[model samples]
Target: MCSHYEGPTADRIHHAFGIRPDGPVQTDLWPGHRGYYLTSGGDSGGLSVSTGTFGLLPHWAKDVKLARRTYNCRSETAAEKPSFRAAWRQARHCIIPAEAIYEPDWRSGKSTPTRITRRDGGLILIAGLWESWSDAEGLQVNSYTMLTINADQHDLMRHYHRPEDEKRMVVMLASGAIQDWLTVPAGESAAFLRQYPAERLQAEATG
Candidate 1:
């Protein structure tokens, strides 16, 4: 359940080692990449979409406003869902840049927000899939969702809370793994769909 994120880099500064506000809404609001949207909400946590602006394209979708609800695609069934199946097969691949990602620790009495970042201050390339939806106006919009995998021993035992019921986090790919992740066959990529080692990541409590 990734919702909040932050990006404070120049729009033209593509592929830097920091979070950048680029994606569907940025394209709609700023017009650039046809696929991807950046979210800095505490819940969305800065994601990259695969489509143009809006997330889904109904067979009868008549307006772009419908997109506001289709921002996320569940990883468990994404490959089987009609809405995401096609994109998952051919039109997938996006880089969700983030400086840090937040997760809640409920046991702390208050909902303690922890900021998880790379130890060396590098960007975390969250794996994503995109889709293109067209409205009655023939305007195409792209959107995306991050994939999640079960938490590893490190994230479950250290970075995240213990007794973690639904221990899950976005599938963050390393910089060196991004190229293979983006171009590999979907079936083969599933092997790469695992939690990043918690040792290489650090989580700091945030205000």
Candidate 2:
């Protein structure tokens, strides 16, 4: 599963998605950090950009730190996981735009950082769920997590991670289907959990 990525800048988002963020955007993101996500059915009733903590903070969480361990939710078990069930059941869908994603390459018998991106040089739009948590004083905090699917057989994805572990990759949406993924009916959103074609992606070891 993906826990690190090269996030897009506000200007890149405006150019690729046609939506401008309300404030400065974070470009480097990891668990427990702040980043931007897009949703369709917010207070605006249209596509809107929002800033949220990278790790999902469930309603039952006593503190915002819960995000650290809740950043990557497996799609196969999200419906039953305590940290993700509510968001998954409520269809709190979102799209996380990134310039690239980082994964570990272990083919050399040692873990080396690798960067994965589209061969076309377009944005990598990842599928995710969003949550809104309120504290005792009514302070609201938004958080999100990337969803992952099994990638054991994927030509490109299977190359990363450890050979002894199950291979998995983050769920991604085709650039043309961004709106459809965010607006799909509940219980049916799972249709978009399919893998992105490996032929369109490229990877390289990074220092």
Candidate 3:
């Protein structure tokens, strides 16, 4: 699962996805961190970029620590996990635009930071589910969690994280399918939950 990413500015996001920003954009986002998420704008065929935490916070969560663990939901079980079922069922889909995603690579007998990006050097659109949670003060906190699909067989992604751990990769949506991902029928969303081919991706170990 991705714990951090480099996102674009609001203007760049607006131009790239036609999503109007509802708040300021966050260039750097990490789990339990706040950022801008682009959600569908209904029949208008537009999008709304709103400030939301990077981690999902179910309405029932009492502590913020849970946000860390809920940052990534298994696409295969998102519909069944209590923390993500509501958002998945309600089709509260969103997209997280990222310049690069930082993960740990443990292939060298030691863990090292690794950055993953499109081979074309363009921003990646990651599919996610968002939800709204309110605190005692009635503060509405909207948050999101990336959906991950098994990637054990992926040529590049499988190299990240610990070798002993099951490999997984974030669901990436193609530029042409951005709107489709945000508005796909709930029952059919599973069709988009698959590994992005490694040939179009690039990765480097960061010192």
Q: Best candidate, TM-score-wise?
A: 2
- How far residue 180's Cα lies from its native spot in candidate 1, in Å, is 0.9
* Comparing 1 and 3 on lDDT, the stronger one: 3
RMSD of each: 7.6, 1.5, 1.4
What local lDDT does model 3 show for residue 169? 90
Tens-digit lDDT track for model 1 on 159-199?
45444565667788877776566666777757767778777
lDDT of 1 at 75: 69
Error of 3 at 91 (Å): 1.2
lDDT of each: 0.57, 0.90, 0.86
lDDT of 3 by residue, 70-139 (tens): 8888999998999999999989999988888988988888989888999997789899999999877888
TM-score of 3: 0.95
Instruction: Write the candidate numbers in order of decreasing TM-score.
Output: 2, 3, 1
Lowest lDDT 10-mer window, candidate 3? 17-26
